[model samples]
Every structure is written in structure tokens, then in C-alpha cells.
Target: MIEVSDPNEIAALARDPNLDRRFETPTCPVNWLLLKRSLKVLSFRGHRFPTMMPRDDAQRTSNQQDLWNLLGEKVASIKTGSDELEPLADWVRGIGPDVQLGILVQQLLGQLFSSKFMATEASWDAAKVLVAAPRLNNLPLMMWWFVSGKVRRAKRLLAGMVNEDLSAVNAIGIAVHNVVKSLRQMRVLYANVQTRSGLSAEAAAEQCLFAPASVYRQATAAGQLGDCPYSRHSLFVLSIGEAARHAEGRSLVFMEDSWSRCPANLWIPAMLQGVWNRASVFSQFHDEKLSG
Candidate 1:
């Protein structure tokens, strides 16, 4: 078990069998038209994202174009029962890593929030003004540029997200309610994440996914959580801290574990090679885990 930490190594790990790449649930449902109209009422029109996503007729909560549908088409086209990996690799390889990261980051943010890519708000309070749920969906948009390949574009998008007065009081519990284990440990775990490693956005996103799985797991245990976090019929507490341990790459081994770490969350880093890809970014850390 190689704990990958090297950036180049991490990028290479994207193609690894252990990295799960899929979004198993639906997003929080919001009326795209109504949300847009509400933005005007709240004067968020100026802060709006320019990217336009095509909505699925069935998924009313979604505002971004579904990629697994587009990308999955490629996956489905592969001949089943064939051991050939090149076809799948070819599909992933066809897309630019930066573009792949951009699509993924925008999709992740869109899933957690809605309608567009990254944007800004007046403050944490102002940030949640009209959104439906709240969670730390705004982590590491700055680093998304390198993996996403559109540095200037990523930078411009990140500008709107920076709230000078952002805080836990105003930041949590509104707009983007999907949670991450990192948020609970932010003051300690994530605040000092840099000391442990370079702290890439890809790593941040990858490590945070296991928390959602724990949330879903507990919900299953008590029979209290939603059908799924991404489901419209799903209803439950959308908070973090319940899951502190990594899912230990279980998602890579089973599609069911994909829910634990949303594919949107995993895909960006996987493409960026900071997680389960073969490049083995955390080789140092992974070695200890396997040996210890």
C-alpha cells in the first residue's frame, strides 16, 4: 500500500483500479428557473456563473450537464467480457487532464450547490442567502486551475468565491449542506494539512469523501437517512463529522462504495492523479499503512 503524496505520482494514479469514478446519487433539487429568479430578488445576478448546464428532464435538482451520461456512454461502448483496458484508458486519455479536472470540479460544485460552475457571494452569510443547503463545498477552488487546465478561468471563478469575512457561523448550515470529514477537523486536520503534505485540492477532495459514506452508513444502520444524498426523495441530516476514517479505498473495489465518496468528488482528483490512480501520489503514506 503506497501512500502517494508526490504530485506527479498522484496524477498518475488516476487510472488505478482502486480509484472509483462514478456519481451514484442525485443532487439536492432546486428549481433552476426559480433559483435564477430568486437570485435577482437577492441581487445575486451580478455574481452568477456564466456556464450553462443542460438539465435532465427527470432530475429537477440538477443544473449541470450530466457527464457520466456523456462519459458513461464511452464506458458503455466498451465490449463487455473483454479484458482489454486500452479502450477505457483511451476514453480517459482522450480528454485533457486540465479540461477533465475542470469538468469534474464544476460538476462537483454544481452537484453540491447548483446551475453553474464556481462563483462568489458578499460574505458567508451572503453566501447562503438563497441556497438550500450548506456545506464546505468551497474548498481549494484555487488549486483546481492546475488540474483543470484553465488557470486564468479557474482564478477568475475562484475570485467570486473568496469572502473576506467567511466563517463557520456563516459558512456552515446553508446553501451547500453536503458534508466532509475534513470540515469537522478543519481547525486541526485540514488547517494543518499543509504541514503533512503539499495539500493539493485533489487530495483535499479525495480524502473528504469518506465522511459522506459514514453518514450514509449510519443512516442505514438507524434507518433514518435519505434514499441517498443525491436523491430527490432522499431526506436526512446533511452534516459532517460522523465519518472520520477513510473508507480505505473500498469504493475502488465496489461500485456500492461510490456513494461513500461521490464520483464528482473522486473524479477530479482521480483525473488529477492525487488519489487512487496508479501514479501513487501518496507512496510514502501508503507504504506505512500497508506495512504498519
Candidate 2:
């Protein structure tokens, strides 16, 4: 596992032939590879189109710019109050203009994993997918699999690294899964601390490692939720970049953490900048993009 953060470094690793690949598997009878591929497709759709995976690309560039502009405004909303910080996840939710986009994204992903709903070898219990908050959306389906251990399989995001050299890189770090657990832990740790500093969670984390007791307390108090004050920011940024890369058919950023740079560190600005490049010219628009 080569620890790497630089895009150039990761690109170098991508050229390596010895690199292995892996992904989390569904715990039930669902086909893991199929599910992964399906999610990848949905991710591509969500990132590529803002209007519930629209087929019209007449304003691709303008549309993307609009989305980003909207995103920027929403991000700025966080700094509007005296808090100067806001939950990243909630902020991302407030950006998109399309309300059905969430449903479309989930349904598409769910349908991709549809074999599980059948009586085939991949069949699962119907009770597992009640039409409720989670199952009503694929979020519940995904959560069920998380506990079942389907998505826990670790995959190497960087192409160039090997297992023996995971410790040598300065830009590398492990990605901590169990996001909610980590955030809740942070809540307990910083239940009664002040946060006026604008340093990001990443900064506070580094400070916590070797700072004095006063600094440790300050760092821990960075936020009441998330892994740090900017955990949501990290999540949003990482998800966008990962979805874009994965959508491009390069699954480099969606894997579990290793001794080296967490997959999130890899720089893929295209994910953010290419917000509205018209959809592929060769491909016809898709209307039946997803089915739950």
C-alpha cells in the first residue's frame, strides 16, 4: 500500500502492474460486483446531471457552473452565523435545485442491485426491505448491508502501491469508516468546548496528535458532530471527487483506508470543475436511467 495524496503520485501508481483491486461486498445473496457496478453507474448519473440525471445537455457548461455557484452559496451559508462552521452533509443537501434527484439516485442504485429482490440465488428476505425511511430509499438498503458486512471489504484505491511499503509515505493516511460512530464519538468528546478558530477538521486532527492539554481540548472541541469541525466538508468534497472519478470509470477514490493516503487525498479537481460538460456526444440520453 503506497501512501499517496498527490495526483501525480497516484497517477504514477496507476501505471503500476502489480496493483490489486477490491470493493465491499453485500452480506446477503446479492452479487457484489453487480451491486458495485450499479452504484457506480448511479454515482455517474448523479454527478453528471443535476436535474435528476437530465438527458438535455444544451447548457452543460452553464449548468455545471450554476451547480457549483449554488454549492458555493450554500457553503457560504455555513459562515453566515457566528458559528462560522456548519455540517457539511446538510449543506450539500441544500445545494441541488432538483428535489427528486435524491430519489432518482437511490432508485437507480437500488435497481442495479435488483437481483436481490428476486427469487434467484441472490434472493433476500422481503422483510429486510420494508417501505420505510431507509428501504423507502436505498439508504436503508445500504445501511442493512453495512452492518451485514457487504461494503466492508477493503480495496486498494491507489494503483501503484504495494503492501510492504505502506508506512513510508508522508501524504498517506487511513480512512476511518463507521462515519456516524466517529462523529458521535466526537460529540461525546467535545460536548462542552468552544470553537472560534476556522481551522478545518484535518487541521484540528493534526493539532490533537501532539499538542498540549489545552490544545488537545481545543481540537477535541472543534465540533459536536462529525469526525471534526470540517468532517462534512471532507465528506462532500471526497464524495464529489470520488463520484466523478468513479463515474469516469476510474474507481480510485471510493475504497477503504490503508496505511497510505486515504483515497480521499488523491487530487481530482475535474470532479468539481467539470460540473456541466455536456453529456457524452456519442451516447443517447437516458430516461429510464433507473428502476427501483
Candidate 3:
């Protein structure tokens, strides 16, 4: 493990955030290898695009081509899975966007053990590399096979270094997954009292007026009935009751967390209810009485 000898060094790097861009001048081991990997992943499943995956491209610029060749050589030389990551991660952090590199490193480390979702046979070497992977996404991927019986895909905007509490990362992953899944449906979007500082459950209730009655009902029923602080700029979705009553294709509203001042956790259940409501409506429309 490369011990960061000085917090000041990282702090200094943060202070001049533009320092990463200096790599544009180009050099050997050109950071483009990490860049290409990051771009590949981002283009594939990132919010920005849907079609993306690994492939060979002869059209890549000379610098990018050189990096690709270097990566192939390094990957070929790497025996232990553990040996493939640290240097790659370090190189990633040194050049290219940190967020992008973090995602790629996490994906690479996860892929090393299993193609994507399956867990590799237990290997001490793979476990060690996963333990030291740079992102929380990697942690959850590692835990899925090793810890939990659930083989769910990891879905959190963790975007940075691995947090100290691995459980917290898991919780956040579950939370974000629930939230995004809810958004895809016409479920209720919840709000909270989060800030750059922190949040309180009490704050969640006090500002609950902005939420729909159904959302409040779900929140109250779940015993999640309080205002909790959320990210400064969070968006939520709520189904339109009138739209559902009319049997419309879909109905939802996007609102800001700050404006609603409600608990964000309530969003998931609200979504469940909306989906249930839509299903009920659909069944009624079909009028297919059961013979039972």
C-alpha cells in the first residue's frame, strides 16, 4: 500500500484542482489508457449513454494507442489479481478525471474476480486487491459474492475514494438503487433536510407539507415519518393521483428536496404504491373476472 505520507500533498492537489489537466501535454505511459477505459464504461452504462462496452479501435490517436498497448502488456504481465490494481489505480488518480478513473478502477477490480455479476472462486490475491480497491462500488461488488447471498448489481453514485465504513457504502448503494428505481416508476418522490453540514429527522417532518398526501401516508406508515437532511440538490418524483384515476399512460412530478423539506427515504415506498395503483387500474380496465 502506498501510504500517503502527507495529507498536505492531497490537500495541495485539491487546492489546485486543475493540476490534473497538466497531463494534456502528453508523456510516456500516457494517461489515456485509464481515460479510454473510463470512456468505454461511461459510454456503455453511464447516464450519458446506453450503448458502450470493450472493443478494439484502430482509429484511436497515437497517444491513446500507445496507452492501450502498454495496458495490454501490463495486464499480460500481471499474475496475481492483486498485482494488477494498485499501480493502475495510482496511475488513474494521477491523470484523467478522478470520478471517471474511480469508476473504471472499481469496474476493473470487480471484473478481475468475476466477469460482471458472478463471483470468482475465492482467491486470497483477488480478495486483497478488492479490499484495497479505490471505490465503494468495488466494495459492494466484492461483498455481494463474499458476504451477501444477493447477486445484485451495484448502483450508487459513490464517485470518490472508498469510505471508511463499508456497511455505510452498502446502505447508500441500496438507498440509491431504491430511489432511482422509484423514479423510473410513477412513485412518490420523497424529500429531506440535508445540507452541506448535516440533517435531522425532525426537519424532515416540519417541511413535509410539500409532499403529496399519498407520499405522507406512505412515509407515516413506514415509520419513516421525519425530515432528514439530503444532498443540497436532490430531485424527487411523485405520481399524479388524478392521472392514475383517469388511467393515463403515466403520471409523475419532479420536485426539489430543498423545496419539499421532507424525508427522502419515503420516496421508495411511494413508488411501490404508485406501481400498485397503476396495476390495479390496469386490472380493472381489463375486467377479466376470475372463475375462482
Candidate 4:
């Protein structure tokens, strides 16, 4: 396994056709077995999660592009003052001062799906399980996680909740969870800086938007990324958030200009800006009331 933290190398590696999403080969046989077992948790029935699909998969690519186009429409409407933004902003403002992560996740899920999106405590637990399953290093626990039907039960609970395509359900749940967690981090940062007078909502959102920690890819052929030489089956762990610390690396946060760039790059910041706009107004009103 190779860990890549440099921004340029990470971007170049991501664009390499030979480096795809398949996790078929691991540096060691033990990991190979573990990865295979863990992948079961990310699947619904026999369908792999959309994010786990190989780039060359025609159907997955088409479906992802369709989702991107749909999100683009939403972003466009938002630019023209869609009514949806205020309600979402209000919902975000309503998050408590010290809400638990699970509750925050549940609320965010509702915002992403329908307000009537049925999610239980177990549903959130199951999503957490799926996210962590890929990193499990304990052989016995990994075996139990799959053998005990825990993975199947979790997938069953989430499958078809979003759409008939099980992959869509898994994809939405995982993406929402990840984005919300990053937003939460941004919220903390925003709180520290929001008191500065005349801070625009756009500036606040841009200052606070946190990047994802890392992403993974597997090599299908030998390649040299930067000065690093990697063989086929080499696993590359790209540290995205770390790379984003540098000015040149900011684009790594959303993978800007890359084929795998996040579709919601514009929408996410806009949502954050809306929330900050509402929250700032509320804060000012409260301050005036106190002063009076």
C-alpha cells in the first residue's frame, strides 16, 4: 500500500486510467481477504455502491452523470432564489448547540432525502457500520460482521429507501453522511470567526468549508506518479484535506477540474452561505434585543 499526500501527484494519480476503483488486489493476501469481506458491507444484494464502482462501468457512469445533471439543475434554481434554500437554511439553524453526531446525521439525512425520509437509530448505526467496514483490520470481527448477517441486514434496511436502484440508496446515505460531517467541522470554525463585523456569508462559508480527509484508488498497471513508482495492484491513499492546506491544493478539496470532481461543489458552499446568512440575521436580532 502506498500513501500519497502531495497535491499534484494525487491529482495526476486520480486521472490515470490504469488506477481505478477496483480493490481486487492488495499488497498482502490477508488484506486482500479482509477487503473482500468488507466490500460485502458496502453492497446491497449483489450491487456494489456507486462510489465503489469502477470508472469504466458504463451504467454507473451514466447514472452518476444523470445525478450530477439533476444536482446542477438544483444549483441553477438556487442561484435564482429557489424557495427550497430558506427552509433548508432554517433547518440548519435549528441544530442545537450541542447536538449528538447521530441526531445531526439523522436531521441532515432528512434534508437530503425527503422530510418524510424514514430513518431509525439503527439506520444511522448501519450507515456508520458501512463506512467503517472498509477500514476494519481485525480479521475475527470482520468475519463476524459479514457472517452474522449484520451487513446484509444494514443493506436491506437502507436499500430502496431512496430509489429502486439499491446503489443509489447506498450512495446517497454515504455521501450525505460525509458531507454533513465536513459541514459540522466548518460550523465550528464559523462560530469562531462569525463575530467579525461585515463578514459576508460567502466569505464565512468559504473560510469554513472543510475538505474530506482522504480517498483511495487501486492501480491496475504499473505507473510513475511524480517521482513515486507504483506497481499494479498498489493502493494509493490520497490525503485530500492535508493537501488542501496549501493554496495550490485548495482545488483538491472538491477535486476541481478533475473527472471525479464532486458534483455538488457549488451547491455545498451555497447551502453553507444560506445557513450563515440566516444565522447571522438571527444573531444580530438577538444582540439588539439584549442591548435594548
Candidate number achieving the greatest lDDT relative to the actual structure: 4
Tens digits of per-residue lDDT, candidate 3, 33-121, equal 33332232222123311111111222223323343354344432342223334433233223333233333333433342234332222
Misplaced by over 4 Å in model 1 are 1-65, 69-118, 123-126, 130-205, 208-241, 244-265, 271-292
Give Cα-based local distance difference scores for all models: 0.29, 0.25, 0.27, 0.66
| Models sorted by TM-score, best on top | 4, 1, 2, 3
lDDT of 2 by residue, 75-94 (tens): 32222221211222222223
Worst 10 residues of 3 by lDDT: 216-225
Error of 2 at 190 (Å): 1.4
Better of 2 and 3 by lDDT: 3
Task: Give the Cα error of residue 103 in candidate 1, in Å.
Answer: 18
**lDDT, model 1:** 0.29
What would the C-alpha RMSD of candidate 4 be, to one decimal place? 3.3
TM-score of 4: 0.82
lDDT of 1 by residue, 132-181 (tens): 22121443642342246433232233334433111111122121333312
Tell me how far candidate 1 lies from the true structure as C-alpha RMSD in angstroms: 17.1
Clashes of each: 29, 10, 11, 0
Question: Scored by Cα lDDT, where does model 3 land?
Answer: 0.27
Q: Which ten contiguous residues of candidate 4 have the minimum total lDDT?
A: 90-99
Give the number of colliding residue pairs in candidate 2. 10
